[model samples]
Target: RGLKFVIRKVTGRCELQRICHNNKPGARRTLKIGRPTYCLRIILCQSALSAHPDRVEKTIDDIMTLKKVNPDTNPQLGISLQASLFQIVGYRSLVAEVEKLRREPYDCENPDHEEMLMKLWKTLRPDSPLTGRISKQWCEIGFQGNDPKTDFRGMGLLGLHNLLYFAEHDKATALQVLHDSLQPKHSKMSKAEWEQKNFDKAIGYSFAIVGINITDLAYSLLVSGALKTHLYNVAPEMPSLSHFQQTFCYLMQEFHRFWIEEDPCDIMEFNRVRSKFHRRVLRQLKNPDMALCPHFAASDLHLVNL
Candidate 1:
């Protein structure tokens, strides 16, 4: 039987090691006979040569063509093809780092965690649109409180969302806690509506904190977590900049509801926040003169005098 191998870097060590074989599908195995051409890594290495999707298929065809013309000379050519098909690659190095962090006894409150987090953030400086390193890091380590957010602020909305997804996957409780922290007090509105509102608000403030940057990834992560998991249900796809802004506004509304119920600080002071683009804040209140009851809206009903 042809042998297969999976090379993984040991956690935190930056050195490659082989995982054991247990007859698991695609498990790494050592061969006593000839060298098997197949090797896999948890993450794919960044390929320097750009292969077009069509060209990759064509290249395989060309290789097969060559093998056919000289079968006697190409015993290993087939092996190479088998290896290429089974191989996997990318940021497994970061995954190892995250796993190492988890096993270590370092205190999160210790100053070293912050240093490690910042270093990890730096390691994820991707020039490409999708950041696989960052994604794998979170998947491996899960959430380490708000430090990931604080350390990763410059990464913008998409970065936050990616982290949030990882947090949710590994630390659902923590993500909920953060959402609760940001949520506004008291609400007579629907929870789904409130979740939407809170997300909208969070997005809005995050923009001031993040500016014009890639945010859809972040927004998608949050929406999937908060809404999909029934923390609150709202739209999943925040496709455009305008949708993100709208979601931000909606999130703010929800946050305000939480804030009212929690009564953490003066409501007036929260509104005084510098708006994204410094736009004036609009207040929604119910008029007693209208058919709605006074308690229905949290804001003052001047209709008591009317």
Candidate 2:
């Protein structure tokens, strides 16, 4: 008789059921299922997330007919379904776009790629001059080697894109974080203690490397649909690169704080700390109302609140 009962009878926990249920007055109990929502996507081709209004309406109609939920009696439910469907399609579309960028290698030959890299350097290190593209000066900002291009191996352009977004938009926060990252993690360690225990001579974590790794983390969460709760709640419309980038900015800053709080003995403990952080975020996303970046509004991370 109810929308949830009818939907489940037709198809065991449809995407709408998995995504739409929340603790609101007269609303069905929340179903924290992820598999069914994605199973719905697998049934439809990639183009099913079409931006065209007619196609979307058709899809909604098809769902209504299949689930036997009358739009007249369940007007509020239908509206909720439409919003959930938008999140599904929006998240899928974002994955496609981000995957395209991830697959693309960082081509130094491409002037555009090179320019973006240089822009990142200049933005992060305003006073410090870049001696050359392949210079060791790149290390100052957390590049692993003389040639920073190699570090972009797995993340590719997406890594550069996220880093540059952080530098350009949140200049003050980004620069301050970079400066902090460069400081030797252990303040009280003497030269003899440093040798006694294999410790980093300077810089706790490579800022650029950690940013790229965090990008990968964000990408993983997005692809796995763990971010759906955040996206669905934060953005009423479609989620885009801007949403993803803002998430990156949030993660990068959060991780820096997390690192300090954890008081990691060495950089080798990175994986353990990162894994813990990932699990904590996953737990947070399990809540339907979770918003990772901005719990209130959709903005370009004024960052002060964060």
Q: Who wins the lDDT comparison?
A: 2
How well is each residue in 46-132 modelled by candidate 1, as lDDT tens digits? 221222334334443544453233434544443433333222111122223323332344334657544544443443322223254
Tens digit of lDDT per residue, candidate 2, span 1-306?
387567777765444544555433111222232234454344334324585555656676766676567778766656665555555666778999999999999999999999999999989988888877789788778888899899999899999999998888777888888877766666776767554532244546888999999999999998997877676656665678898998888888888889888988778889999999999889887776567773223354333211
Q: How good is model 2 by TM-score? A: 0.79
> TM-score per candidate, in order?
0.21, 0.79
Best by TM-score: 2
Q: What does candidate 1 score on TM? A: 0.21
lDDT score of model 1?
0.30
As a whole number from 0 to 100, the lDDT of residue 117 in candidate 2 is 96
